[model samples]
Target: MRIIFSLFLVLSVSTIFSQEIETVQDSAIVKVDSLYREDQFYLGLTYNTLQQKPQGVSQNKFSVGLSAGFLRDMPINKDRTHAIATGLGFTFNNYVQNLAITGTGEMPFYTVLDDKTVFNKNKFTQLLVDLPIEFRWRTSTYESYKFWRIYGGVKFSYVLYNRSLYTDDQSKVVITNNIDFNKLLYGIYLSAGYNTVNVYAYYGLNPIFKSAEVGGENIKMKAFNVGIIFYVL
Candidate 1:
């Protein structure tokens, strides 16, 4: 009976020691994961929509495109609850249309009077290269409640290529003639996302053109963008 009691005691001690070792291993793994996530890099894609309201024009217009870019998190605290990311990307848009023509200057290429070519209102495409920077704030941890993220940044884009107009149609015009293809672009971005879906908006602080005389004195590009982004290492 004394030998059996000794055996049971040894078994119980061994089980407790095994459980303690497992708990330590689990804790070490969690710490490693936290460190990795804090310093990781990511890339994503987004769909964007733009609007322009020229100072003298009465109509409000919009454009749509897809954007691709890379981002990195800049943690604001040791816990990595807040971060900032900045990167460069390109946006591709097609089936574009121009809405709201004002003044006596409506383009003949887009008007009903044009017999040679007409604006489909359903067919146009624009492509741009953009740079974006965002400041973000996040929740404390993966299991935390009341979770949210807010980002504000800017994007500079140049219309690298466009398929929305006709070369023969002199009526379709963008006023800025001296635009430095390398220098001129739009700016400012704000967004909110939960987990994998984010809604973003942008505003152009600079004119796409060098002068207002051509596209007009007050034409500007402003946009509201809504798209889904997945984090990939």
Candidate 2:
């Protein structure tokens, strides 16, 4: 009788242990199915348009820009439906406006109001470090990465490198000096969509140049960007 009782006790403990292991596995699966994940890598490209161009300047309204960066999406709610997002990125802005950036390395540079015929490619491209902060809402789950989402926030950028490219039938010239661009830019943006494709819009809160003086008249130029935003990771 002692042997039989000992055997029965051992079986009972083994069964309890097996049951507990199965329970834990089941709970883990449930949590995985309910949890939502965020993609931290972002790639953006947009049609860029220069707004409020200095008077007497004409440009092709259809210019484009590209951006890439990483973002941190922090959950603001227990359910993971709301988040505050921020990231660091870089952007390129190109414009075909008929403004020539001319400056001698030793002197102050200025945007000379001129004709496109004078310079083969009279476009200014902006290379900047972009910082974006947004409030996000989404319907997402671990099992389904596809869902509707809306993100509204502001982005600020600091120009790390800037230059003007002017090409002609004979030669291409790059101007680095005497170009007076606002080193810093701040703007508001919004992104909304489902899955990998999203619509985005940005409006600048600052002028594109520190100062634009043509014919002694002060001019202010701003940026307006519209495009698509993509998440990589």
Candidate 3:
């Protein structure tokens, strides 16, 4: 009967091309399990508010610290949304204030009428060590889970040591021969995080102390900063 109607129309066109190749391999295994199924890491804790600017001093003081770091995820367009992160860290600080001396401010000369020496006072403390590198702009959906993230970076610091001394009454341990640690610092950071805890702010254009003249006139050191970060993952 015409060769069984041409073998039943070639087995119905080979069963519709084998059901369209198993529906394209089950939609590519659900798009590779939603693109890279999961594997990322992060652990963090940071706090910084150190300040110093002495080129023409107008009185300024602030210092507080603690930091730790490690974060990963850098994606540059691949239907992976977008991501970037790089952070390495260290911070330990303290800068308090209360100094007054102006009775013609005779360089370290105390006449008992005006001498409130407590500027740059240290009692075995003053440390700052930092290295922060960042760049992140992720709008979620790269897959593992994200609610928000926005970062900006640039942070480098050095002042790994400090000293303080004062022990009189026949014990003599006065080591306050002008405190100034030639450190090079730069800042401009911003951050926002959720699920791991992140919040930061820093603004220092470099000026912690390189100016002098207590009775001749000339001093500068003052800027601004803010902080709060905790992402122990």
lDDT of 1 at 80: 76
lDDT of model 1 at position 153: 75
Listed per candidate, the RMSD to the true structure in angstroms reads 6.8, 5.2, 13.5
Please, what are the lDDT tens digits per residue for candidate 2 over residues 1-233?
Answer: 99999999999999999999999998887445444448578888898887887667777556889999988988888778888889899998887777766554234344554553555577778889998998889987666778898989999999887777767778766776334678889999998999988998899999887765766756578889899999755
List where candidate 2 sits over 4 angstroms from the true fold: 1-35, 105-118, 170-172, 177-179
Q: List the residue pairs that clash in candidate 2.
A: 39-233, 40-233, 109-178
User: All candidates' TM-scores?
Assistant: 0.59, 0.79, 0.32
True lDDT of residue 185, candidate 1 = 67
Candidate closest to the true structure, highest TM-score: 2
Task: For model 2, give the 10-residue run with minimal summed lDDT.
Answer: 104-113
Off by over 4 Å in 1: 1-63, 98-124, 142-146, 165-183, 209-233
Could you tell me the lDDT of residue 52 within candidate 1? Answer: 66
Q: How big is the positional error of residue 143 in model 1, measured in Å on the Cα after superposition?
A: 6.2
| Tens digit per residue, CA lDDT, model 1, 111-188 | 222333354333335577766777777664744433466777777776776443423333443322123222446678
TM-score of 1: 0.59
Model 1's number of clashes is 5
Better of 2 and 3 by lDDT: 2
Better structure of 2 and 3 per TM-score: 2
Model 2 global lDDT (CA atoms, 0 to 1):
0.79
